[model samples]
Structure formats: C-alpha cells, structure tokens
Target: MTKPNLLPRSSDMASETSAEFSWPPLESNPEVFTEYLYQLGLPSDWFVGEVFGLDDDSLGFVPRPAVAVIVTFESLKKETDAVAAAKVDFFMKQSPKLDYACGVIACIHSVLNSLDSITLVENSILEKYYRATKTQSPADRATTLENMTEFQEVHTSYASLGQSSVPTAEDDVKHHFVTFVQNALGQLIELDGLKKGPVVVNAASSDILKDTAAVIQARIEAGVYSDSLAVLTLAKVADDIDAAVQALIDSSNGVLEVTSVENKDGAKVSRIKCTATGHEMPPRADIVTAHVNSKRFKKATEWYSYDFAQFEPYIVSHRRKPKCLFCNVTGIVLNKIPSEVEKHMQGRKFVRMKEHVKFFDEAEIDKDD
Candidate 1:
C-alpha cells in the first residue's frame, strides 16, 4: 500500500543533485542482511534469511507468514515505454516510494511498507530516515539519503560485506534490488526505487511469500533477468534469544548468573554459572533443560568432592572450562567428575604421563605467556 513512510512527492521539488553519489552493491546474502539490519534497529526477534528457491517447495522452507520477499535482479536500461508497458489496475488507482543503494532502497522499501510486521527501532538511523522523508519526493529522498551521514555510514559499512570485489563510487553496479510486500489490503505490491510508482504484483493474496514466489516465477519465465536471481525473505526466526536468556536468568532464583569476562583470546564471553554450587557452564537452555529433567546431578557433588578430589592436582580450568590436566595434555574434552577421571586414568596415555611425571597445565601456560 502507499504509505507516507517514504518521501511525499511534490510538483516543484528539485530533483537535481549538485554532486553525484553511488552506494556499493550488496551481496544477496541472508546472513549479511540479517546482521546489517540488526545493526540498524531491526528487532532481535526478526531476521532475514535466504529463500532457497521460488518454487512452492523452496518457498515452503521459509518461516511461515513471511512478511516480505526481496529479489536481486538485473536493473535493465529504462525502456521508453517501460512505465506504460503491461500496466494493470486494481479497484482503485496508484500512489507511492532510490539509489546503488538499490539494495538499501529495497531494504527500506520492504521494511517501511511492511510496518505491520516490522517496527523500526525508536531513534534508530532507519527511523530517523523514515521520519525525515515521509513527506519528500523520491528525488528529494535520494538527496536526503546522500547527505545523511550516519545512515550513509551504516550502508557503506555493510556494502563491503558483499562477497565480490567492493565496487567503487565510480563503478557501475549491475545487481539491483526490489521488494514485494503486501499492503494493508493484502494486495501484493512491488516497490522499486527505479519504478514510476508502486506496481501491484497481484490483486489479492492469502500468503505473501507464496504469492511473491508466483510473481517471481512468472518473471523468470518471461526472461526478465539475464542472470540467475537471488531471493531473500524477512521473517520471525525465533524468540529473541537474548530475551529468552534474560528470562531464564530472572527465573533462575539465584542459582544461575551470567557474567561477561574476557577470555585468554580477549573476546568477551558470557559465562554461565550455578552460583549456589560454584559451578560454571555454557549459557544454553538445553543444558538447563537436561539438568532439571534428569537425575544426572543428584550425585554430581559427591562425584566431584568425594570420589574425584584425589585428582585435584590433575584438574585445571582452561578457557573457562574445567578440564582434566591429563586430557588437555593429551588433547580432548569435555568436563570434570570422578567417574570420568577414573575412566581416563586407566588409559595407557594417563599411565605414561603419571609414570614419568609428565604433566601439563594450559592455564599456567596462558598465565606465563
């Protein structure tokens, strides 16, 4: 649907730019788009993922209730009659929403038009752009985009994430992006900055992604693009993982704590711990799940304190993980406990290490280094 989220067109608005600017082409990658959007205030619960194909089977792989579908296709030369070509109408007439930032444009088009599914983060660079240009013309919006340093900086940063050689400002990029989003009325609408206006891809739709796939498939059959095209969709991938983890912490009843500490590699890591027991482990729901549902921990302390205490000199912590000195010296996993210690102690390697007094402590090595 034509929303005021983009620049409002005007009769006398200037379209001329004193200086030209071009955005680097972005790769049609879901991971890259997902990360890029995340940096731009896309809610953590939502993510962009690659659409394997336009066929029904392939589209089925996408998360259900797909909010929008974007295509990376060739931006062909503007035909003299392209605007009037294959024109179709709906119950009413038309209305709205630029740049090598065709990728950025498509990203913006898909997001702003799909407000029902996406709420741009408050005060985010994208939100500022949406608010600033809702009443400007496409040309004016282009000029605004070129001048918005913060937003332009973000676009430029992600442009380099493209898989191929980064295109320079002077280079002509071949790949272009377009978005297909369903308006409020469930009508399939096409948003291309290069187009005269929003093109209604379909009059009606039960499923946005499925209908989008049909439209793209039709375009493919008509030989619209010379090269293979890539498709990506925005969807609700999962519950916000961080939020889930936070909820877990809130309900942990002082049994669990998540702390950020730098490891030997100098990377910040969230180390999960059982505060009451002074035990630490990775921050994963399934680990918490298995413990609550299983009896494995019923004798856990006894396993460590009573039976495993004899190997105290052989125990050490590495990379925030408690490991058997004998095992790390031998290159292995996984954890501490007396039964496991006894099992490894019977090994010939353990016997050899014990016989000659050959012992190694990675924790000590790291400290020395």
Candidate 2:
C-alpha cells in the first residue's frame, strides 16, 4: 500500500514530521516483515522466504503449507486499474480505516483468518486477534487493527530499523506490498490492505502453489513487474521446524541411539537416531546438554574462546555482503575462525574503529561515522 496522507501540503510537513503517530516507512525486506510476525508471538521458524522468480521452479524455495504470499512490486498503470476493477463490494463500500501500515497487517490477518489448520499458540496475539474479529467484516476488522497500540508499536519498531543513517525528506512512492492466500472458501484471494476488501483471483484448487505461481507469472509477463525485479515471496505461518524436531526427540519411546556424524566441514555433530519412527535428526541444544551432563559424550578438545581484545564494537552482520560494524565499512570478510577474527582485530582499520567505538559508542558511531 501507499504511505499515509498525513502531510498533504508543504505547510503540514513540519507538524507531521514532529508527530508521534505518523507511521514510519518500513523496508520491503521479507526479514523485516517476518520479524513483525515474530513480535506478534509467532515462532522463530515461521519465516518469510523470498522468491527470486515467479516460475514453477521458484516454488521449491518456499516451505510447504505456505499460509500467505506477500508480493511487493512497482505498480503498473494497467495493473492498478485491474486491482481497482476487481475490488470486492465489502471493502469497496467502506472508507479505508487502516493507515499506511495496512498492507503488512492485512497480510497477517488474512493468513490467520484463512488458515485454520495452521495452529497458532494459545493466547498469541495472532490467535487473540483472529478470535476477537472472526465474525466481523473485513472493513470492520481493518478499523479495529488501525487503532491497536500493540500492532502499531511492533510495526513502528521494525520501520525504525529501515531508517538510514542520513535522514531524507523525499518519499519514494514506488514499491507496495500485497498478500496472496487461499481464503477459507479455498479460493486464492489477493488481500491488499490499500484495496477495499479481498480481491478474488481464482476458485478452489488442489494445488494453491501452482495456482498462485501462475497468477504471479502472468503479472510479471504482463509488464506489471520488470522481470526478476518484482519481489515475490511466501511467508509460512507454521510451527517452528526446530521446535517440531525437539518434540519428536522428547516423545520418542524407541531406542535412542546417539551417534556423531561428520559434517562437510569435518565437525562431529551429534545425531539422534530414533528407532520408534525411524527418524534421524541433529540433537537439540537441550538434548546435547543432557548427554554432556550425564557423561555420555566427553569433551576431548581443549575449550578455546576468541578474545577480540583489539576489535571494535561489531555485533554481527546478517546481510549478503557483511561489513565491519566498527569501521562502518563493507567488504570485511566474515571469518568465523578465532584466529581469523584475531587477525582482523589487529588490523589498522579495526584499531582505528576501536578508538571510535570507545569515544562515541556503537549507535553514535553508526550515526556520525
């Protein structure tokens, strides 16, 4: 959806900029959107996986039983007209209650409302929000969502992360996020919070993945998205895979055979083989702890810790191209080995960064450097 029209005139810009209620613009990254779901009490494994393409092969990247797909694209003129034409009566009739962040929230609600098979933990924000508004119209639900302080707080928190070190006054009015999911009726529906209501795309299908893929592919070919640039992704609202694996180990009544599997990197990882279900999985942290505590597995190697005495204040980088957080510069190789870390620590650039971190601290260094 578009940014809220809080500052329509130049005179109002000053007041709107100072206003606390103005929705901070968020990044279009799936990670940010996924974190918003986590803040709403979803598990860590219920993640947003980005789809690189709209073809059938692209579906492989997405985890199965995907509750929703959020696609962000540069809206084309004809595509915009198509969306306006296909607007449902329910949402079209009502005025837009939800403000700028409606697209993200709408996708969240659409997934929770439609996917009953996916279990949301009891008393979760997703569960509670769904139950409280299950009977209301989509428009009414949007109205309720617009006023929720908790959601606004969570949305604002992530949006702040998208803010750059250099604040800009110009607003980019190109990218928009829209969600796609199979509604309770088994029809693939497009839920754009900016739109009046859910837009019906197709009827019930055995494979919603292929159905959704086809729809997305058509849009890409129709010039709605410049190939590969169109952001298409599937965010599954499901249980944590790690948590599920743990549950299996806890409940297994079969012979628990513990073995050390040699990983590709020559590391000996603990493997738990359960005879009951013939399932084999890597041991969870707690399971490994139990084994170590009970002396089932004894440590042979000496415990060594990296001491970055000369390193700067860098937490860690998650981006594709990692950088030195202390230096505020990119291209620093992410060498996890202690020796490599120590070597990087002794570098002149890092030493200079250490001085800056000591003087200004991490936040100020990020801002001022």
Best by lDDT: 1
CA deviation > 4 Å runs, candidate 2: 1-20, 80-99, 162-170, 228-369
Which RMSD does model 1 reach against the true structure? 11.9
Candidate lDDT values, in order: 0.62, 0.52
Residue pairs with backbone atoms closer than 3 Å in model 1 (clashes):
8-135, 8-136
lDDT accuracy of residue 342 in candidate 2 = 59
> Each candidate's TM vs. the true structure?
0.57, 0.53
Report the number of the highest-TM-score candidate. Answer: 1
- Report how far off residue 50 is in candidate 1 (Å): 0.7
Q: Candidate 2: give the clashing pairs.
A: 91-196
TM-score of predicted structure 1:
0.57
lDDT of 2 by residue, 1-369 (tens): 998743122222223223344455456655566666667766544456555555665555355666666666676644553542233222311223334454466446444644554556556666555555555676656655555555566766787664463122345546666667765567777776666567778876456667777877787778776453434344443233355345544653334555566643365565676442234444443323333334222221111123333344453533453222222332365543445565666778777765655345588878986
